[model samples]
Target: MKAAIIGAGPAGLAAAEVLSEAGVAVTVLDRMPSPARKLLMAGRGGLNLTHTEPLDLFLSRYGAARARLEPAVRAFPPEAIRTWCGGLGQETFAGSSGRVFPRAMKAAPLLRAWLARLGERKVTLLSRHAWAGWDAAGGLLFNRPDPEPLVLRPDATLLALGGASWPRLGSDGGWAPLLAARGVALAPFAPANSGILIPWSAHLRDRFAGTPLKRIALSFGGRTVRGEAVITAAGLEGGAVYALSAAIRDAVAAEGEAVVTLDLRPDMTADEVARRVAAPRRGQSLSNHLRRHLALPPAVIGLLREGEAPPETAIKGLKLRVTGVAGLERAISSAGGIRLEELDEHYAFRRLPGVFAAGEMLDWEAPTGGHLLTACFATGRAAARGMLRAMVG
Candidate 1:
């Protein structure tokens, strides 16, 4: 049997591996000149493969889509991902944050090894082939630089085109209208794992545009995440802010803005902060007092002063108004795609037979630190299995 996968990303490539191993001739096509550009870029700061947290806690990171992705994740969980990496001669290690990474800590090595293995299995990779819906004869149409588009007719096809984020790296959500025209249900794409836009004062924007607020905790919508964030010229970005992005984004959509409280000293209690703030200033400026007593950095002090709260209360709960989220071009991933209800358990479109989808193309969002990649790999494998079953039956 021949199978065509219209994407060369983690999901499409993962599916290709599964189908090829099952004796299916798989052809992996991509719009980019090379495959897995986003994966390589993401690895610049250590390629996080998966998380080692307990299964339940890990699954909860997916939020509303937990139930839909549970089966695939359970079947090909973090351990399996590690095993797969090892099979490619890339050993894996878990960091202090419970995030997994290849021993090389770079995606290029892992991707290179993966592609070599796929090549050995006779999986064909056609670059610069952008899927453009279907031809008159129901064949897959791919637009190329040439005048005529390329056409393919495989026994089954998997649409792993990613959501509309990082368009430069190949997942521009261009496939949305194509599927929507076919009468498939879809949710409008939105930013996921994106930074929050805060209108910083001219002083803060000019002086601390790139400053890092380290060892801070951010709270929004009753949830708190402890990590670090950087002050951008226009807003805040980084791990801590990204964890609460979805809540903040939705709140902003409904209320025009969202307030996020930053705990400058997460390790200390409110009373401890108050006590420190009450300590004698000894003629030192308030910034010096905060620096000496609370150990808050300059950026944190600037941020605290931006709010109307006094130093004592602001030290523990300095609120910042988030007016918007970073656009899809800057988002780490995207939320909302083909709605989950449009796909059956097999990952195949209920209305478009023999055509399946996996990865970010589905309407699910998760925080950083490995949740995104894990689901992509898991669902890709699951979709391949479903396609195989469909072919047999």
Candidate 2:
């Protein structure tokens, strides 16, 4: 079988790895100058390949998409990822947070080795090939952003274009429109694992802008995330904020604004906080007292001051305004893409036979913590398996 895999991110490359190993001659076409721009970007932060945790707990991270994606995940879970990294000569270790990393602790070295392996496997790569939808008579077409066109045909095709985030590095969610044009049902792409845009007060912005809220807990709806948040010039952007981004995004879209609560001190109890605040202080400034008693970072202080002083009763539960979510271009990942209903168990589009989709291109959003890459790799392999199954008969 011959395979043409599009977008050389984790999913596309994973598909190429699986199909080629299955004796399928594969050609991976990418719009980027090189493969895995997002993967390379991820590696900059120590290349968290997957998480080191039990299967069930880890699989639950996908939330609503869990059942639909379970089989693939079970087949290619985090342990499999660590094993694969070992095969690539990058030894792995689990972080204190349970996120796995390469011993090299860098994405570049691992990627360079992975690319070398892909080359050893004889995967033909065509870089700078912008996919221009399909040509008449049903074949692949390419537009190099020039006058001429490039065309290719294979026994099967897999489209692993990433979500709309990071358009500058490609995966511009442009594939959504193209696939929709080809009669594929697509979910509206919304930013996920992204920061929420808030109306920061001028004083707050000036004082705490670019500050980090350390050891903080953010609450929205009924859930709480314990991590650090960074106060950006525009608003708040950080891991904890991103963990709640999907809920916040939908809430703001539905209600125009969402109120999120930040537990300025998640580790301590409100009673503990209040008790500390009640302590006698001789001519100490409020900032110094708060700083001394609670150790609240300047960012948390600014956050607390965003609204009227919480009555001492409300000091522990302070609300922050999230006006909107960061734009897709600024998001870390996206929430919406090809709806799962459009694909069968094998991840092949029901409407377009011989065409498979995987990775963030599919309509699923997971928090960071290696769940994103796990699904991408799993779906890529699943799509390849689907194509292989179809060809065998």
Q: lDDT scores for all predictions?
A: 0.94, 0.86
lDDT of 1: 0.94
Q: How do all models score by TM-score? A: 0.98, 0.96
List clash counts for every candidate, in order.
Answer: 0, 0
For model 2, which pairs clash? none
Q: Which residue pairs of candidate 1 clash? A: none
lDDT per residue as tens, model 2, 1-393:
799999999999899888988888999999889889988888787877789888999989999999999999999989989999899888999988999899987888887887787888899998989898999978899877568888888888999989999888787988777888978888888898998888888888777778887787889989999898898878889989988999999999999999988777778888898898888778997767777887765556657777555534345778777889889888988888999999999888899978888999989999988989889999999998999998787
- Model 2 has an lDDT value of 0.86
State how far residue 336 of model 2 sits from its true place (Å).
Answer: 1.2
